[model samples]
Target: MTFFTPKKLPKAPLLVVIITLMGAFAPMSIDLYLPAFLQIQEGLATTDSEVKKTLTLFLVGLCIGMMFYGPLSDKYGRRNIILIGATIYSLTSIASTFIANIEGLQALRLIQAIGAGACMVVGRAVIRDVFKGKQVAVMMSVVQVIMMIAPLLAPLVGVMLLYVFDSWRALFWALTFFGSMAFFLTFFFLPETYKKEERPKITIGDTFYNYFLILKDRRSLGAMLGCALPSGITFAYVTGSSYLYQAKYGLTEFEFSILFGLNIVGVIVSALLNIVCLRRFNVLTLIIFGLCWMSISGIVMLLIGGQSLIGFFLSTFLLMCVSGFIGNNIVSQIIELNYDRAGAAMALNSSTQFFVGAIASLLVTHHQELLVPVMGISGILAVIAYAGLYQPWREVRASIEK
Candidate 1:
């Protein structure tokens, strides 16, 4: 039961490594089992649609759970919430392996997402707690690079595990091991970022009210849209990729894994570019740049992605590359504006992202044919939302003078 009480916080590089791994829980959960979609359907004796519901419901739970954990972390402390969440996540993952039916597995996944939500909400709060200004964006990009590793490697690992064990249940075992390690990491290494004196006196009612307050603030709401809407494109791709690659494109499991991994490599490239660009460009500029490119990439995708695999691959790669630039910048803005309410602000930001992702999941699942068009539309709408709502040109001009 050792807890870190370092008078000096861990260095930025080390801290980024720790928090990114913790924050990666949600992505790891989704990506790791992706290659086994067919196996899961067979094992549970369920439809592909039912399996997709597991992903959608998990995202819905993440939305609900983030709203709860964010304010509570503001009231209580980050460390305890993380510990409790990791415990829930680990236990649920273990339970998943033994579930006899798809319904039971879906229930476990929903609960697991709730537990995973704590890590995501609180991890961003920790960054806000420790860093400031462009430093926040820089740190976040570093975090994004580390976090992307989960998806970059997860599918490949899942494919290998499938090859060896020939059972999708082995994937849950790996998750069980990961969740347990996360618990130990939090207990021993993670410091309490939300101190007692700074802790807000939050009530049950205050938690729900906080969401309203955030949405009421136009800048906060706009930055949120800038962050969340692009996520719909991401989820649409994630939800449809397995079906697209394997069923339609006729790629083998290992081949699909490699192609999926390449998209992550695109993200890493953009993230590195984002870190370098932060030295000179304003955060708003980087965000606008990313969104604009994303829209262009999506348009290309809509034009030929449906008919040609190469067109889809190249266009999706470009979209993912630019996407790496958006989240860290937009999140840094949301957090700086709402520093006093970092927990709630991040909760709303993340919850909205996941909610949009849930809707995207449903669309991509039901109408796989429309995946390219949906991606295009989501990208275009994201640009409109940011431009109309946030009005970044004013800030861009301000940054130039500074």
Candidate 2:
């Protein structure tokens, strides 16, 4: 039942466990320190923008690293890239604790993100490599549910840590511990799902050409953007939630964490529901459903307005609930489009998702009120996403169903 044991060999479930752990690193890195943003700002003697830049840099690092890791993993195989990235990730977390300035912290977070990026992109490729048909869909749902646990509870852990240490530095040390755990797990239990014969040759020109080829495909590119745009609003909320709840609403860290956790819990529930739905519905069908609900959630937020905290909580919860359904389904289809070059496909999906998210988060950080702007943009973006996909939904659906 357990994935991690000294002498136990890896199983199918164990691969899920390892990949899920890898996926959690980014969310945990983001969420665990959310409760400490203000404390970090004060301690490091930095402006709000500077403190926010740490998150932006982390996303940027993910973006850049995804591009690199995808091609490199294709060339080098999954296990070695994961191990190397884990080592880099762990070391950076330790180094992050020692940084005295905001700039150093930002730079180190970016490096940390680069390392963490390997697990996420490569993990997805591994899933595609190992599973087929509805099995892939279900396995992704399972991995998504498990991966989301860190975000669901990380803030609670962060709050508990703050209560004990009363310092932001505690988070980085905790990250170091997390990084080490993931590294050990990957090194010990994860087998190489990518075979040597299938590995792509290492060449810069070929990698860039592949990326260009990917972009030239209208359907794939459209789906990728359609999925990523509304998701940007989710990141906007992530970047702004602490400020929105704690500073604006006067909720304590514990209360804010509880509210924050609600969204993640919603995502988990939605993902599990998606697993049941996937047996009957195709990926594109679930995506359309997700987009519709996301738009509706955004509208609810706009009507509910900023003053209604319960309304904000309910609407935000609804908005996040759709993330799992849309992201996993659309991404699964994308992998199917280029299963042979899965690393590149996943890399493009993740890189664009976070890149767009980082920009949205950065914009939200500058605003005075988090609720209205975050919710408003989310609604508009959802509408835009729906519009983008509406034309191709039927075509994509038929293809996926077949």
Candidate 3:
């Protein structure tokens, strides 16, 4: 039997929105607390680095949770897994608001991450189950557009919560509410996409072997690495930006949020460009162009230092835009490479990206002053990714054409 393509989908718009909402949960969990990082540290009497550990723990939970959700979704169904995950996420987020110490908060954040991870992996798997080829590309673009709105609004929402409530916990409460809404929406609207007959009847050993197979595939591995390296760069920025903007630049949390919101403009433009370009250019071309943009942005950022806000903003904007291009295309390409076990493939992809992101965040948190080191490392990774992924990807495209 053939995979379900977009032309076969009945309610395309609503389905796209639901899938996008599920994907948005992960970013919302990460970005919403960013503006309050300094405040939380000060209030809880924790070191800046310790506060950053919260983010790291969240990533750890995300990676671990992704691994489990893929197999469970395959066993049960997409809608069931999503509903369970979302409910858990909402409960954990509310629990986070009641935590008094940094450690307690960190623990709850980890649980929240786990729930978000399930949503992300399951959402992608459902999309892959329902779409293929150019339709999948279009659906991926739509999902990105929907997901982008979360990061664009997160900092601003955090800032507003701070202004109104005068406490970081308010942000957690907001997250809890959002999670609750998502949970209900998933239960009510999302239907099961995966059929029992389609699932692999495999044991633990077979699951491991399947994972190994994906890792061994040159094309799949390349696409996953290409996605992960750029994501690491973004995570480095996310982990460092609180300190960089507030402590170094002397901007208030509100001002920093406003600046962060401005950066989303770049993401919006880049995503729009990706949507337009996909009609004409192959995914490999987009990936190549994105890597070039990232390398240029990293080099420019490193060369300029913290000289002017405009320079920093321009560099960061360009970098984020490149991310917009890489994020959707990379996943789209990788998902195409592993159709039979799409859930497992997507879970591994999410796990690796978050694991790499966690490491990048930890590095930046430990070495905040050394901006050059972070940017340089990211640039080097982008170069390797281009050489490893885009080159092979081009050859694959040519062979397909021939």
Q: Give lDDT for model 3.
A: 0.80
Ranking by lDDT: 1, 2, 3
lDDT of 2 by residue, 257-361 (tens): 998888888889999999989878777778778877877777777778565778778878877787878888878777776776778888888898888888877
Whose lDDT is greatest here? Answer: 1
What is the Cα root-mean-square deviation between model 3 and the actual structure? 3.7
RMSD per candidate (Å) reads: 1.7, 3.5, 3.7
Per-residue lDDT of 84 in model 3 = 74
lDDT of 3 by residue, 1-402 (tens): 023222233377777777887888877888898998989999999999989999989999999989888877776668778877888899998888888899998898888899989998999999888887867777788788778899889998888889899999999888888888777666656657887788788775676567789988877887788777776767887898888888888999888888887777778778888899998988777877887778887878777745776777777776777676787888887877887778888899899989988988888878886554575467558658657754665666777899
TM-score of each: 0.96, 0.92, 0.93
> Model 2 lDDT vs. the true structure?
0.81
Every candidate's lDDT: 0.87, 0.81, 0.80
Q: Model 1, 280-369: lDDT tens per residue? A: 987877898898898788788878777788888888887777887899899999988888888999989999999999999989878887
The reply for model 3, stretches above 4 Å from the true place, is 1-10, 306-308, 393-401
Runs in model 1 lying further than 4 Å from the true structure: 1-8, 11-13, 397-402
Candidate 1 TM-score, true structure as reference: 0.96
